[model samples]
Target: MHIKEFFSPDHTRLSFEIFPPNQRMSLKAVMASAARMAAYEPDFMSVTFKADGSGGDQTIQISNAVSEVMGIPSIAHLTCSGIPKTELPAVYDELTENKVKNILVLGGDSTRELGEDAYLPYAKDMVAYFRERGDFTIGAACFPEGNDPALSMDEELRHLKEKVGMGVDFLTTQMFFDNEVFYRFLEKARTMGIDVPILAGIMPITSAGQVRRIKDLSDAALPDSLLRMVDRFKDDPDAMFDAGLTFAENQMADLVAAGVSGIHVYTMNKPAIPERIVRDLGRLFHA
Candidate 1:
């Protein structure tokens, strides 16, 4: 099913993002965990593409299993960083053979040095390519806090408008800890005429290491309240987990109360994370 059809003005939808396991982990084990997550009956599940594109085969396999075997719609991430344009036909054939209907186009971390002729340098390029390639539903990423710290908000919004104009069906945001930041972004996007449904990405930071990684990766604004809680419980594993989960619960509750289009949890391949979220926000999701 096209993910766009899941969005409604009256109801907020729930979705989960899972990644392909590394070489040491067996596909069967990840599928088992996916089965557990599927029991919650989320609107859909998205399988992430590896940064270097080494796990492209596994991504396809997992997405196929999640959709065909688990009986849920799946959005397979297709990255343009390491993959060559010449190789796209085979990948598209695989997705078609597997009956996958949705794709999230991204320009993931480059595994090799790129020159001027790089296949698809930006996510927008891939979105346009996919739109012309087939009849699949396409998704693209957005940054509520701004993807590049150097780019002005006007420049960022201009680029985002161009991307959505290139036939993007919807957008999933990079995770942010503050709802107000997202609200401001939504207002700007609406005012700019980018009216597609935007799913708010929520990542539950269960460990101090994740906090450090988040700081290094994106310009996601972490609230002082959350940082204080993490600093207080960084040394204690159990306490840190509880604090992180509760923080995510409260954040999601606020987003739901505000009637956001949808919530996409970056599961990090952990079923327990979304399990707790579903348990705490049960009525919000059902409402």
Candidate 2:
């Protein structure tokens, strides 16, 4: 299914993301994880652009393999950091040739030596860039917390409206733990008449040590209730894993009950996490 299609009323969308391995031998493990997660039947899986801008051509092949060979929709994270805008056409060509139609346009990380600090600056530009030329459906990122005091809600909304104005088909968010934060974002978007479907981004932390790493990873707010769980179970790996999954399941349940259009799991390319998440969704979504 297309990424945009995941955001429908009757639909329940769960997605996992993977990074293409640099070595041929490790590809087996990546594929194994992909296949194992496939049993739960995610609506789609996304392949990330590796850090340091080395894997464009390789990521293209892997994304195609997962989408065409595995018979599951795959999203390409096409970042414009190290690569030049003038060179993006070949990237699009590779994706379309493989029949992979969905892409997440990212400004990506910094390429300072290249004298480019913004790294595509805004996703709105990326949305418009490919949209005017092709049959691709694009997804862009949003931060629900709007907590970056550096950027106001109005400013973020302005850019969001710009993306939609430029033909962006859908929006996913940076991970957020507090439902109230998401609700506030939704309400504000509604007030501003920003009607694009927003997929809720949920990152499930399976281990206690992951707490620091996850905090450093996304703009997700750490709720007190969840922090307490992490602190209490930090010593026991088994207990921490169970508690983490349970917390994530509970969060997903709340999002489902509150009528989120879809759910995107940042699986971190680990089967055990998505495996457990999929196992819980059956009862969580219905209960």
Candidate 3:
């Protein structure tokens, strides 16, 4: 189902994100996680794409399993970072053949070096490229906190407006720790007339190492409140995991109470995280 059509103001849905396993041996465990997550009855689930496209086929296969076999709608990530412009149509065809209807286009982390002829340079270009084909429900990424300090908030908002103008169906934010940041972003986006269902992307910070990944990915500052938790439980794996879940639950509860359109959990391939959140939130999801 197209996410735009699936969304309604009357019902707030929870969704999960998973990345394909990097090793062949890990595939079974990842699939098992997906099955456990599927039992939670989330609105949908998404699979992350590899920047190098080496695992592009695996992305589609996992998305197909999530949507077709597991009976949840799915979004497959497609990155333009290192992929040739000519290769996108085939990727779209692969998703279409697999019965996948949603896609999240990202600029990805890789440096763009796909020969001199590759023209699709950014997420906006990918959105426009696939938009021309008029097939999928296209999603784009946004940053509540500007992606980099070099880019002014105005400049970031301007670029985001351009992406939305390129026919984006919806948006999911880069994971953030503060709800206030997301609120400010929503206000700015509305003022700019870039209206679309914005799913607040969330990652359960289950380990101290994930804090580094969050910083590297989005330059998101760790608030002192969360910083203290990490400091207190940094050495104890079990305690850190439990504290992380509680922190995420509180964040999600506040987001839901504030009426965010959706909550997109960056599950990190751990099924238990979302299951626990849904269980803890109870019917607050649809409230």
Candidate 4:
């Protein structure tokens, strides 16, 4: 199913993200990890291309394993980094042949040699290209917390509306520690008349050092209260993990309560973490 439709509030689906390992030796680990994650039977699983930092035949190989072997509906990250606008159609056709019906269109992260025009420039361009053929459901990134220096919230709204006009089916937000930001984003989106299902992305931070680094990298505007708790548990690994899980649970429960569309967990290729978070959340869902 197209992720946009899958994420509807009426459906309330949950999904996960995974990356193929860089080295050949790591394939065993990735397969084992996928096996473990598959046991959870999420609504769908997304295989990333060049996640955080990595290299591989990222799209075809990993997606084939997930969709063909695991028999799970897989969404592949199709990037516009360094590729010309004309090149995307073939990749889309390949994914379609493999039964991958969803794609997250990304302009990719900036790097040294990448220069200013490192990626497809803006997401709308890709959305326009894909919408013409209408082969796959297209998704684009949104920053609910508004960290992009170049674009204000209003500017981002304009960009989102443009993309929607270009046929963006759904949106997945960047990780934000606080729920208020998501609430604000949803309000703004509704008011602007961009009414696609926006899946909330949560990254459960498992360690204190991770919190510090992620805060800087993501511009994660966590509540000062969370900062204080992390400070207290900075050296306590077990406590840090507990706190991370707790934070994620609370955020998800609140989003569900607020009638957010769906949940997308950044599993980081470790099934145990996402498994634990989902298992814990299941009780609330039941209750």
Candidate 5:
């Protein structure tokens, strides 16, 4: 199903994300997890594009398994960074052949230097390119806290509007700890007239090391309360995992109450976390 059709103003949506497994052994484990996630029947599921060379083919294969085999709507992520401009058409062809209809276009890790011959320089161009091709429902990434430091907030909003104008069907946020940040972002996006449905991206922090990794990756400011929880449980893995899940549960509950378009769990390929969260939600949405 095209994800755009799922975004009705009358009901909130729920989705989960997982990545393509690189190894043959890991593929079995991930497929098992995918089946577990599918049992909950989220409105949709998304698979991330890996930077590894085979990410393109693997993305199509796994996405087909989830969508065609498991009977769930799936979104395949596409990244233009580090990949040759000439490679994407074949990737798109494979996805279409597999009947994958939803896509999330991303401007991958900024730290990775782009090659001189990269075709789609920005996510907007990628969105435009796929849009002109005309069959898929396209999604673009948004950072609720803000994106690259080099770009001012005004500049970022302008580019976001431009991307939507170029043909993004919806936006999914980068994972954030605070719901207020997402609300503020929504307000600003609406003020700027970029009105497509926005999905709240969430990651359940299940370990002490993940704290450092999130900080290193997104530079999102850790609130004092969250920091204190981290300090209190940092040494106990079991306790820390429980605390992290609690925090995510609370964050998601509040977002659901606020009526966000969708709650997208960055499951990190851990089916248990999303399974627990979905059970807690307990028929909150028609989806």
Candidate 6:
């Protein structure tokens, strides 16, 4: 099913983001994890693609399995930065063959140099390419906090508006800690006429190491409250895990109360994190 169909005035949808296994983990293990998460009955699950484009086949295989074998809808992430134009057809053919109809296009890490044959440099370009084909329900990423530190907020929203205008069916935000930041972003996006359904991405930071990694990878503002909690429990592994889960639960509860379109959890291949969330949120999902 197209992801857009999941949006409605009656209920807020839920989804999860997972990635392909790395060298250390076996494909069987990751598939087992996917099956466990699928048992939660999310609206859909998204499988991430490697930024370097080396794991596209694994991504396809997992997405196919999630949709075909697990009986759950899936969104396959496709990064355009490292994929050449010549190789695009094979990728499309594989997705078609697997009956994977949903995609989230991204202009992966900008630090990586684009190859000579790379034609799609930005997410907007990929949106246009898919718009012309009219075959998939396309999703693109947005940052409540601007993705590029160099660009002004006006510039960022203008670029987002242009991308959505090119026929993006929906949008998922970068994981954020502050709900107020997401609220402000929602207001600005609506004022700018970005009418598509937007899903708030939430990541449950389970360890002190994850806090450090999040700081290094994203420009998302870490709230003072979260910092304090992490700093207080930084040395205690078990306490840190509980604190992080509580923080995420409260964040999601607030988002749901405010009636956001949906919540997308970055599961990090750990079903227990989202399981805790679902258990906590309980009837809030239906209310």
Top-lDDT structure, candidate number? 1
Residue-pair clashes per prediction, in order, are 0, 0, 0, 0, 0, 0
Alpha-carbon RMSD, each predicted model:
1.5, 2.5, 1.8, 2.6, 2.0, 1.7
Better of 4 and 5 by TM-score: 5
lDDT of 4 at 73: 73
Q: Model 3, 238: alpha-carbon shift in Å?
A: 1.8
* Candidate 1 Cα misplacement greater than 4 A, ranges: 51-53, 113-118
- Which pairs of residues collide in candidate 1? none
lDDT of model 3 at residue 170?
92
CA shift of 240, model 4, Å? 1.6
**What TM-scores do the predictions have?**
0.95, 0.90, 0.94, 0.89, 0.94, 0.95
What tens-digit string does per-residue lDDT give for candidate 5 at 8-71? Answer: 7767788999887765437788789888999889888998887344545577788888889999
- What's model 2's TM-score? 0.90
Give the per-residue lDDT of model 4 (tens digit) for 1-287: 66565654544567788887765427788878887887887777887776545563556567777877887777877666634555566776777677777878876663525454534677688777777876678888888877578888989898788888888888888888889888998899889999988889988877777777786778668788778878888788888888878888888888877777777888778887778866877654433
Looking at model 4, residue 265 earns an lDDT score of 87
* Rank list by lDDT: 1, 6, 3, 5, 2, 4
- Best-to-worst order by TM-score is 1, 6, 3, 5, 2, 4
lDDT of each: 0.87, 0.76, 0.85, 0.76, 0.84, 0.86
Per-residue lDDT for 86 in model 3?
79
Q: Which stretches of candidate 2 lie over 4 Å from their true place?
A: 22-25, 51-53, 117-120, 283-287
Cα error of candidate 4 at position 207, Å:
1.0
Better of 1 and 6 by lDDT: 1
Candidate 4 residue spans exceeding 4 A from truth? 23-25, 52-56, 112-119, 283-287
lDDT of 3 by residue, 1-287 (tens): 77778887766679998887765526687788898998998998988887234565688889999988999999999888756887877887887789888989988876556564574778899899889985789999999888867899888999999999999999999888888989999999999888899999888888999987777667676789999999999999999989999988898888888778888999988887987888888689756
> Model 3, stretches more than 4 Å misplaced?
51-54, 116-119
